[model samples]
Target: MRRKKLFKMAEVLTFENVFRDPTVIFGKWKEFFGNDNDIVLEVGCGRGEYVIGLSEVYPERNFVGLEMKGSRIWPGAKKMLAEERKNVSFINTMVKNVFDFFGEGELSEIWVTFPDPQPKPCRAMKRLISPRHLEMYKKLLKKGGKLHFKTDNTMLFDYGVEVVGADKDFEVEVVEYDLYSTEDRADLAEAKLVQTYYEGKFSALGEKIKYLRAKI
Candidate 1:
């Protein structure tokens, strides 16, 4: 393994965070944060740009970046630890196994920032915003909790809007086909200012970042 990869194994929460017995973690999130603050999740949190950056913006709530790749999760995890951020954490796990960690009604919000669009017609189920993930999130989130999805892929953006719109269980709160167009919505506007590494690359190539906020 590389030096930085070694560092990630030693410093951040990896597979070790999950005990061999998954049942032991039932409803233990508040204890992990050492408080009952509202927890925010960033699924597929690549490089943890949204997790670390937004955790700073909203200190009262706790943030957890869920990513499978240790290398991709290393930078933000290290930075958060160095800064001594109490409200932020990361987990090395696949997005599909989210239920293995969190309990029902335990999460406040979920942010799926620039997730894989899975644009291929045959890969619709692979998209992060697919119904399978939505059903999973619905069980974890508190009543009226929010799920935010932002992406540069037009196909993914439209798919997410259609999925959430058709689903009566969730209400689409804010729909911004072009997130950077205006600072109209305070929360969404604040989010736009913090771009992830992938987002920056896409922005430079003149891609219009799309956004949608859904309440469940």
Candidate 2:
């Protein structure tokens, strides 16, 4: 059986509507979690499944999902709107400009789930987990904040481990070679939390999943 929709997913919590006009997000943050500290951000939030699931599991923490394509984001946004989940919000924007939406040391956790592999050597620069993106993540995540990543591509996972390892601020740990292997399935399911549309399709065809966790 299919699971119930965890929370109302939002389509567009625009900058102008949420942050641009405000001097500080503290107030809005408080409104979501009357004095809580477990805020998390998800980049490239696709259909909002992971963010919404997280919000449902940890109601005290505020969750924000960022996505560029409105067409790809609408279902999750509509779910957020339908559920009226005050703790969750969706930003309709490109991942490359995430800093514009949040301030330094503002998040306690971040997730980069199933990002495009960009397998070509020359196209590697376009991959989401590159050195440049890690720098951007460092700006927003608090010291010791964690980055949890999962993908189906082994090349991308290996590349991410290499890049994050070379960065002084990030401590790479909990690298998994095959996330969905029978012995690792339970752990992967609990840690990864939710799956995206593409992930669902891939899993149906018996594709293996890979995952990693790192601290920044």
Instruction: Report the number of clashing residue pairs per model.
Output: 0, 7
Full-model lDDT for every candidate? 0.81, 0.74
Would you estimate the TM-scores of all the predictions? 0.90, 0.82
Cα RMSD (Å) between model 2 and the true structure? 5.8
Global local distance difference test of model 1: 0.81
Among all candidates shown, the one with the greatest TM-score? 1
Off by over 4 Å in 1: 1-26
- Candidate 1, residue 155: CA error in Å? 0.9
Off by over 4 Å in 2: 1-28, 31-35, 182-190
Summarize candidate 2's per-residue lDDT along 18-73 as a digit string, tens digits.
Answer: 33223345346655445666779888878878888888888778888787765556
